[model samples]
Target: MNTEQQVETLQSALLARARALADETLARAKHEAERIGAEADTRLRVREESEQASAKQRAERVYRQKVQAAEIKMRAELDQLRWAHVQQVLDALQERLTTLVEDDAVYLPLLKALIARAAQAIEDGDLVAQVNARDYTRLQAHWSTLAAEWVPGKRIVLSPEGEDCSGGALVRNRDNTIRVDNRFEGRLERLADELQRIIVERLFATATPLAMRG
Candidate 1:
């Protein structure tokens, strides 16, 4: 081949090689860009999924907290209601006892029984009997015979100072160290828990049948 023709052929060959390299480089660049875009899309999807999962967990936690708060509030309200109901029953019982104290015929026998019970509880015959102001005078009139029947051996003393009690008697040992409280308030106080249990049971039983209550 001639020198110019050879040179021209060399130039053409060089130009074709450059074009091929440029096309390959562009293809590589495009593939790299596509790979980068796919990776970015995957990362964005993963971040969104993670955020959604975290939000769901947070919402569940908040829901649980709300439920617990509501349960505690309801329990507190129920407790208050139960306490109010129990108090109302006790108040009614106190009123009834006060009415009983006003009736001498009904209360006198009860008083005698209370004194006897107190005497037995103290196990001491020589004890001072303390009563309410109204009962103190009545007890003074019957002291002689009452003492003879209840406590024969030991001397019984009726306190001139009235007790701040709702009927019944408080019998104390000779030195006033030991005492047996047979007063209405004292007895009721001692039995308050049992009375409250019974009252609650009855109230619930009436409101709901035993099977349904469970």
Candidate 2:
């Protein structure tokens, strides 16, 4: 072939080869871009799902904490109410004892029984008995006869000074080492815990729920 014709054919072959390379490069680049986009989409979806789960967990934790706080507050309020009722019962009991002291027919026999019990507790010892002002006078009038009848084989004497109490006797041994407190206020204080328990059981056994109360 002539030189011009051969050069044209060679040039055409080279041009076709360059076009094929460009097309292949463009296809590879497009495939790489598609892979990178798919990976990015997967990562975004996973991040969204993880964030949603974490947010849900945090919300649930907050809800649980709020519920626990509410329960604790409710229990505290119930306890306060229970104690208030207990105090009322205790006050009523004190008032009842005070009223009992005003009635002599009932109170005098009770007082004698208290003295006898105290003397029995301090058995075989010379005893001293003290009472409140009202009871001191009542007992002093017939102390000897009553004392002999109450505690037969024991030496007993009434104190000149009255005790600060609400109508019962405080009896002690001669040496003051042993004493029995058979007084109204003292007995009440000693039995306070048991009384409170009984009061709660009897008065609040069928108590309504605080939320349902009017």
lDDT of 2 by residue, 5-86 (tens): 9999999999999899999999999998999999999999999888998898888788878777777788799889888999
Q: What is each predicted model's overall lDDT from 0 to 1?
A: 0.84, 0.87
Q: Which pairs in model 2 have colliding backbones?
A: none
Worst 10 residues of 1 by lDDT: 205-214
- TM-score against truth, every candidate: 0.81, 0.80
Q: Give lDDT for model 2.
A: 0.87
Q: State, as a TM-score between 0 and 1, how close model 2 is to the true structure.
A: 0.80
Error of 1 at 115 (Å): 2.1
TM-score of 1: 0.81
Q: Indicate which candidate wins on TM-score.
A: 1
